[model samples]
Target: MTPSAEILAFMGRLGHDFARPEFLVRALTHGSIASATRPDNQRLEFLGDRVLGLVMAEALFHADTQASEGQLAPRYNALVKGETCAALARQIGLGEVLKLGRSEMLSGGRRKEALLADGMEAVIAAVYLDAGFETARRVVLNLWRDRLDTIEDDPRDPKTALQEWAQANGMKPPAYEQTGRGGPDHAPVFHITVRLDNGETAAAQGSGTKRSIEQAAARTLLERLEGRE
Candidate 1:
């Protein structure tokens, strides 16, 4: 079911109000759905990307007075990045509202991280356009406030960090290979493998917006290696 009024009311408690219900509808629409039958979400996705930037900027500035652009940039990226957005989407049960084409639905597109992330971004943008900046910022912070509070500096992508760890150990650099991917064009998976030069291989699975699956794959490999020792 499209997110019902109760669901929206619950979302409102998170600080999001839809001035344009149509935009909200578009944000939840996937391209796979027939254009005539379902409102396409791509446009809102585009707008949402920008809205996310503004909202995040406001959030960083509003929440922390000491943060400079350098520090704020990474934090903002972590919050608004595709993987982060997907995680937030799932937390709010956004997946339950998406409308997909028969093919996409059959392919389990409703639960895709990519789709959810994009839709969430679109939704953020839509909210900004419908209402104003402060409201949108509130919406973002309400959903992501906890994550923001728990923020840490990862410094490097997990793959890069993993490779550095392997190389310093006199171990050959780790190799990564894609195993599989599935989901809508906007959101796809890259199942990956991380291997050490020692002929040891480890596998892991994760879902997200960017190469998050790779991060999971790398973390998995690291844990398995640690476990073996």
Candidate 2:
């Protein structure tokens, strides 16, 4: 099949025209729609994940001259995590260019955070393959400019913080339970409740996935307990 105008438009938005157009096509192809001639983006995603990590690490390290390893680590994790990738994908309209199978399309695969995140990574790999690491690094730095600029210093994972708080207060570890799921299989919403042994609890719904929903619930509980909310 011919690549759609939308795909070209997305490439323009990404600020990189493919040297090999097929790389872009393959990057946009989801696993559910993969064929012998139309390979999926999983391999590209793998490479792109590394590329993204390296770029983020370098950027973070340089951005903060005095930040210890401990401070830089969590900031790196937060920037490279799936949720952040998905948000970046949405910023570039990556979901609009994705090629998905019929079932996935019907099930809202384009909106699924997992798919979007993977697609973003695949696109990064595609850019690297088309040009070089320098080009890919430039693209990533440009795309992630705002996030990198505004990233929290000494970021802490909410779940870890919550667990630490629980232990400090002599309460059992926080327990997370899935309370509900809705929407299609591919784009399901997850509702989760995080409860501490001491009776503090918070519930939250997220469109990302079970892990994101659970994280959100944990963060909400942490905020509530800490009186931040």
Candidate 3:
């Protein structure tokens, strides 16, 4: 089937022409709108996640020959995390082309991080299937060019780093608590506070998820403890 002008335009932004337009269509379909005759992007999202991982791992492996696995692991995670995928999707206006159910649309699904991230992965899978691994790799590399170039040498997760710092200083493991929550149920904001045994603490708020807020709080506290902030 011929792709609509909208899909074609999205393809232009994605830098890929679909040999099988149906794949792109399937990738954009959300579970909320799926039916017996229409499949959701969940399966495609799963496949795309692996494809993205492989592409990122290979790229990171070649980008820094001297970097050890311990260093590369965090960098890879930073590059391919759900937040990064969602950011990429927003950059390319992928949310504009998402085919969501009425309920999802009413709930502002297009702007949702999880939904956008899942869609990004599905699109990657679609590209991998439509062309080949080489083409998919090229597309991914192009999309992530800026990030790949400027990725930190030690982009460790804040929680892990904070835990290590606490342990090294002879302090007990840090504790995190939810101080408050606000906003609508569909997209609530989480307020998290991280505190060490020594009474040092930091608080952060985010709509990305409780875990993300916790990470942010940890980062804040860690930076303060290390005199970086």
Candidate 4:
């Protein structure tokens, strides 16, 4: 079957041309709009998650041959995390091509981070199925080239890093508190504060989710603690 103009344009952005375009279509199909004939992308997302993990692990292993597993683990997580996938999806305009149900579309499903991340993973699975591991790996590496190059600079998750810092400094683990919340229910904002036993603290707000706000707060606190802010 001939691919639509939009799919073709998306392919250009994705840096891959699908031999079986149906896979691409299914990758973009959310469960909300799925039927017996038109399957959703959940299975593809699952497969792609593993594929992405393997690709990232291999890339990190080879990129820093001298680094220990402890050092590489955080870097691997930073590269293959759902947030990273969502950011990459946004770069390629993946949300614009997603096939969502009316309810999901009305609820701003296109902009949802989880949905976009899942779609990105499904797309990777599609690429893997359409071609092979080599082609999928090439596409993943190409899409993540910038991130991969910079992953060594600050690869640890903010919360994890903050906890480790506290432990190393003979302090208790950092405490995260939900200070407040605002905005409408559909688009609520979370306010989080991360405080250390040393009486240092940082606050941040996130429109994305509670966990994101916590991470933001942790990052701010970490930066302040390290005198990098």
Candidate 5:
């Protein structure tokens, strides 16, 4: 069968004319719907993850001549994390093309961060296989252009920073608790609280996921303590 118009349009946005379009189809296939004839994107996701890491590592190494390994590590993590990949997938309308089973579709799998991130990585691997490493690198670098340009010098996650602070002060790491949840199952809001060993606490809400909500709470707590938020 020929590629659908929507898939072709997605390719236009992706900026690669696939030599083997089957790869793109496989890349968009989710595990929830996989079958003997139609394999899922899991393997592609794994390859794409490594591909993304290598490209980002090389880019960071060249982008900042003065940055130490410690400084570059956080920046690399910030760029290549699943959340960021999912955001990029959304930007390119990847979720719209994801093939999922009925259950996953009902559960809003298309909009899931993990699924989107995995799909993004799979697509990267598809590009690599369709053409070559340089082509994949080009796509990754182009897709990550804005993020690469704007990444902070020290881009550690707030949760990681908070834990470091706690450990340095002879305190246990902060604890995160889900205080409440609201909204529909497809799009839920989570309330999380992060409490330090000293009993200092911060609470925040996020519309993404439990992990994101917890991170938001940690960020809020860290900002408050440091007078940055």
Candidate 6:
């Protein structure tokens, strides 16, 4: 899709406008692709991670007047988790539009949750810097309403969540296929294929975001895929 149309659709879903179209493009650029394509989004990704944390923490802390410092931690974790970000990316059709390196593309980086999740955060950071704080808040909060909707007021380990779901369904705990790795020798994205006893499978991309979170998504996707079996 044309960048203009893509940005418009993203903005429509996000309920905000780009203060600078350039930031949006830069945010969309991935390191894998940017080495050849142009500017990289990794720097933007770093900025967005902090911006999202601050904004989400602010919203969680202020939205509920009675929440203790302890109560807000879990809520923040759930909201900023990689799965949440990946869901947001899929919502905006980011997967289909990402410009990835040939190796990353061949290895499924375009559909990798790690990449999508990081890209979304980078986009948020870019929006905030390009526009302003409130605009970024509007965009992030609007899409993350579901997270706010189910604020348990505490943190729950997603790995635990997956185990609970499995046990509830009388199924064995999930198993992960450690497929391979990507990125530089020092930093690598771990590829895992989650499978269940019910003959279903789904892929997960795990890395520095949190190994447990990626495992949870893999487990969740495995169960989701199981329903179709």
RMSD from true fold, candidate 5: 1.4
Highest lDDT against the true fold, candidate: 3
Candidates' lDDT values, in order?
Answer: 0.74, 0.90, 0.95, 0.92, 0.93, 0.76
- Clash pairs for candidate 1: none
Ordering by lDDT: 3, 5, 4, 2, 6, 1
Give stretches of model 1 more than 4 Å off. Answer: 1-14, 36-39, 61-71, 163-174, 179-191, 196-201, 205-210, 220-229
lDDT of 3 at 134: 96
Give each model's clash number: 0, 0, 0, 0, 0, 1
Q: 208 in model 5: Cα distance from truth in Å? A: 0.3
Measured by TM-score, the strongest candidate is 5
Please, what are the lDDT tens digits per residue for candidate 4 over residues 60-90? 8899888998888888889888899999999
lDDT of 2 by residue, 61-96 (tens): 999999999899989999999989999999999989
- Provide the global lDDT of candidate 3 against the true structure: 0.95
Please write out the lDDT profile of model 5 over residues 63-152, one tens digit for every residue.
999999989999999999999999999999999999999999998898999999999999999999999999999999999999999999
Q: Write the per-residue lDDT of candidate 1 for residues 1-229, one digit (tens) a residue.
A: 3567855864564466565576677777788874776768888888888877786677677787987777777777777777788888888877877778889877667677788888788778778778887777778777877887787755345676678879888987788778777765545555777788888776655445336766887877776766777
TM-score of each: 0.74, 0.92, 0.93, 0.91, 0.97, 0.68
What ranges in model 5 sit over 4 Å off? none
Q: TM-score for model 2?
A: 0.92
lDDT of 6 at 50: 88
Candidate 4: give the clashing pairs.
Answer: none
Tens-digit lDDT track for model 6 on 170-209?
9998776677778754346677676667776666675544
Lowest summed lDDT over 10 consecutive residues: which window, candidate 6? 206-215
lDDT of 5: 0.93
lDDT by residue (1-229, candidate 3, tens digit) is 9999999999999999999999999999999999999999999999999999999999999999999999999999999999899999999999999999999998989999899999999999999999999999999999999999999998878998999999999999999999999999778899999998988889999887787899999988888888953
Q: What residue runs in model 6 are displaced by over 4 Å at the alpha carbon?
A: 1-3, 158-229
Name the candidate, 1 or 4, with the larger lDDT value: 4
